[model samples]
Target: MSIKTQKIFEAEFLLEDMREIIRKTSPHSAFSKDDKIQFNEKLKKLSEIVEELRTNKYTELKIKYITNGIELRTREEDFINIHPIQAAGRLTLEARKALISYGDGYSTCDWCRKPFRLDKIHRPPIDEFHSELAEFVGMDQARVVPGARRGFQAVVSSLIEKGDSVLLSAISHYTEFLAVEDSGGTVKEIPLNEKNIVTADATVQKIEDVKKNTKKLPKLIMLDHFDYMFGNEHDVYGIAKVANEYDIPFLYNGAYTVGIMPVDGKKIGADFVVGSGHKSMASVAPSGVLATTDEWASKVFRTTQMVGDITGRKFGIKEVEMLGCTLMGGTLISMMASFPKVVERTKHWDDEVKKSNQFLDEFLAVEGSKVISEYPRKHTLTKVNTTESFDKIAKTHKRRGFFLSDELRKRGIVGEFAGSTRTWKLNTYGRTWDQIKYLGHAFIDIAEKYDVPVKANKQGQYSGDV
Candidate 1:
């Protein structure tokens, strides 16, 4: 059972990715064949060890297809990765340890009983975890979806009818648009304010305008607590109020807020809450949660009344929106494993923001660099303008925009877009203070090396003025 395994979970995942990379190349090429053979050899060795463990394992083993960041690892152990989306999603040691036990197919369903639904599974305490997750975000009920996008799909498909209108932020994620489209609904954008932030006033005007033109209220109102583009907090509480006033249900998109920071769905007057486990919670890819208030839980999570035409059977307990159970694979298990740590991390969010602000404070010391995100950093994700700073160097450098990525990689900092210089985003979530400090110094050091002017630095202070 509990075999003392090495940290091979990540190493083996990387090996699988390596195989995939070679598969996409010229298969007939000798080089490709050679690389594939080498990968297969190592994989076989890993498989042998896994087989030994599995024969004796009643509990833990070192075998699982962990599809987290397989395509691009950036070696978090060796490099400081500020990749905007992945900074928080990196799995905890416990989550990896969990993979040893539940990484097999449908591992979480071994004790499925009664209604035979995922949320009803009580052996691993999954049913209770669902309840805890609901309360974690201040909602009455919760279900894990494949991703935050799927969470949007569940809400839209549950409510939206053909030709119905939905309200969304002008800078809404593309997946939101797709979710509405799948439900045969048209979405009208609520334009951002001068500060590039979505406001309740704008949402109100958009709803009224849609109502006047279409002669009916929109089916749903969806807004991000923090938009992905600018990582700027929107007027979500205000929008919730507007939605209530307009007699419309509001879905709070918490892809950026939920796991990293405390999200009170009831307090925000949210009819539904959607969060990304792979984006904020320290979990595997394609995992998230959709929570709803008691008022909307019945409708959104409505069970199927479909009967088997040939078998003459009914599946009344199965949720139509979820198609019974949403996440039943390793993705769900990983989310379960990371839940406790994720809950505790939310409390330290203020400290994370402080680290973010501190890093930005020094980053701005590079004369031309600017922070495009909201000042003083409410959250760890941010958009920075390096056009006037790094872009200047990129224009004259031989490697062009790649010069930045290349240099940062040399300094053990990674996750920036190669050949990108103008405007880009990064996250400082879950990084240690020392790592954050080194990140700041790395940028400042690079700037000074490039002959960029430096401003006088007052360290450890929030310098929002760039």
Candidate 2:
């Protein structure tokens, strides 16, 4: 068959179109001759990479590890893997194809030719998509951001000032601390209860403590729906209510909740809601959505009316925090393509939770293993302490902690942090019942092989050995 008849012909056409657009839009006077030549060389390299992807030239680089999709690496598996991080945002086949098709240039912006305004008349669908996204999270307005951290940054920069105090969970993600610090605000952590869960009472106490210590009410209260370290669910509803009582603006960090579970920002009493597209929205990396209620929309999404000081050029656009246009190209397109599936999957979040609990039960059945997260997990990400069971083997084993990793790998298991025999986390978010059962059995079998006593929990029956 001729080259035109090949599957890559469409990719070739798209690349050529992109090249033509770049050439036509290029302001030759803005760049020196050498700079233009270098730019052209980079474009050529990009074109070659696209061609290689179109022809499936990278198949040889595939890894065979069965991690259940925990880490952010692609695999050639036919079925879904039982990974915590990978399960929620795992790209659909359709999303992958969409990424390739729209990967050539800033396709969305290039086609729409609009900046700052998400709801432009020329880009009706983009505007509609923004509306749908806002509605999805039960917020009044929303904008695509580079990531969830950027969402936090935008809100903090707009609302916080130097020496302003912000409230966060004791187990809040590092990004939250960085966002507040970058905005010149001080962070006060709400201590966790013995259950490893952040309670509303603790939040209230922390808020009052901050007021007393700093002699000022906290400017913002940010809490995660589900913490990353332990995957434990926090009492965001209660915390939000507390924020309202104090008249403090609340920002809901839904990095682990938004796309994977049902979240209503207004119902939760949040002024702002942040979601990670790459973490839970089934999109590529560095993509996220920042949403806000109407009460805070004017401040967070304020438009720019600045004029160039030197040339007196008026640039009417959106806020500088958003940096004008946000996500474009493959990231936005893939998110759009995966929206329907994500919507449907979130409706069945109960099933995912049930599976997670079941897997945890079997893992706990092995004597000396205990789950560190709250019992009857509300989220799929879990922290466990297996020092009694697994670490016991690591004490004298020749390979030490690595032996467990080697054994798990032999059983077609991956995603667990290597050399971690004592305390570690795993996500059983999207595993099939069979896979979950097998995973549970794999741990028990490995323990038994190591001569660790295995006593299955049987109703009221007590094993004094354990």
Candidate 3:
């Protein structure tokens, strides 16, 4: 059977069984001892669903619901629901197992033993994994954090003081702003060019401007490899060079690049590197890695050496900023399980970009569709303006923006933001060639049905004339 067919079949088959299980597991349900035993037996019979969950057989599941007197079923694909294409870094099979096995409290602690350090030398596996993580990002030391934002918090808290200036891209993620603000530091945004790319020259100018205005150099420079809004790749290498010349510490925000693309912290001249496990490292939510060079590791990961003056007690084991250990449960294990696959996939990043651009070309084949992001797309996630074609229908149709979403849904496509017709974003990450082709065709078919003017390119790919 085809991929879509298989998924639909699986979803239909599991629906009733899962519903029954959920009913039995509901907290409101009152079960006698015998009833509990019966439910346990029933759960054992649902070995398939359990196995699927354990193995990460599918990244998403479709559910049927009766709404407004109409029966409807829809697929819930991650990341794509809000954007066009999914990013390459979703959870892996091993990650799913790790989540289940280590999700219980103290599981990680049990394995690592005394001190409970994620990178302690006594625990060879955890220590080795820590070493591997550092090596993966070309840094001297690494630590798993609650998320990328925590990594930012750690670095900012370590470096920034009240009234200090920090340089950031105008399009930087909100978490960066929060991190800086929490550190009592002032932010200076590096303006983007017409292309929305943060150029090295612009960063240098901003640094000089900040120094002139504040009478002091900014304490840190943080920039994203690919901004979330546009998924546009910036000149990080160039920016890093500028930071080096100014003797400013640079933090490379690799939340979108670390697991999906190759990055070298040293090569980029980054004093610190931060990455998101859920967004790009094939792990569950709220997990990330913070890596730094040897020069800064002592400061960023400094151990707690404070003593309780009255009690005469000392706590010297935990890192000050980390607050003991971060990513203690399934999150860390899932990241560990996904590390090898993440490493392997980064090698084929070029092919992934090629596929992204190919799909974009076909998508733009529809008349009046224009890509809002940079051309010759370097990233899979793209912002698009569909004002000319889809928006025309949205203007007249009673359903408005929802007409396009309904059409795509019927064609087994999901992920486009609901009620959005003029401008929207989508990610085409981790999709197979066949799926990509079908997606392009789905859009073209919808436009043709609505009488939208669509002309095929010379290559005849997605020529709405079909």
lDDT of 1 by residue, 91-118 (tens): 9878887875677778888899889899
- Top candidate by TM-score: 3
What local lDDT does model 3 show for residue 288? Answer: 88
- lDDT rank, highest first? 1, 3, 2
Expressed as tens digits, the lDDT of each residue in 78-171 for candidate 3 is 2123244235446787887677567777567775666667677343277788889999999999999988999999999999999999999999
Give the candidate number with the greatest lDDT.
Answer: 1
Considering TM-score, where higher is better, how would the candidates rank from best to worst?
3, 1, 2
Per-model lDDT: 0.86, 0.81, 0.83
* Model 2 per-residue lDDT at 43: 69
Regions more than 4 Å wrong, model 3:
1-86, 121-124, 461-466
Q: Is candidate 2 or candidate 3 better by lDDT?
A: 3
Clashing pairs in model 3, backbone N/Cα/C closer than 3 A: 80-415, 81-415, 83-426, 84-426, 84-427, 85-426, 85-427, 85-428, 86-427
RMSD of each: 9.1, 8.5, 6.1
Return the number of clashes found in candidate 1. Answer: 0
Q: Is candidate 1 or candidate 3 better by lDDT?
A: 1
Worst 10 residues of 3 by lDDT: 73-82
lDDT of 2 by residue, 245-314 (tens): 9999999999999898999999999999999999899898888999998888888888787888999987
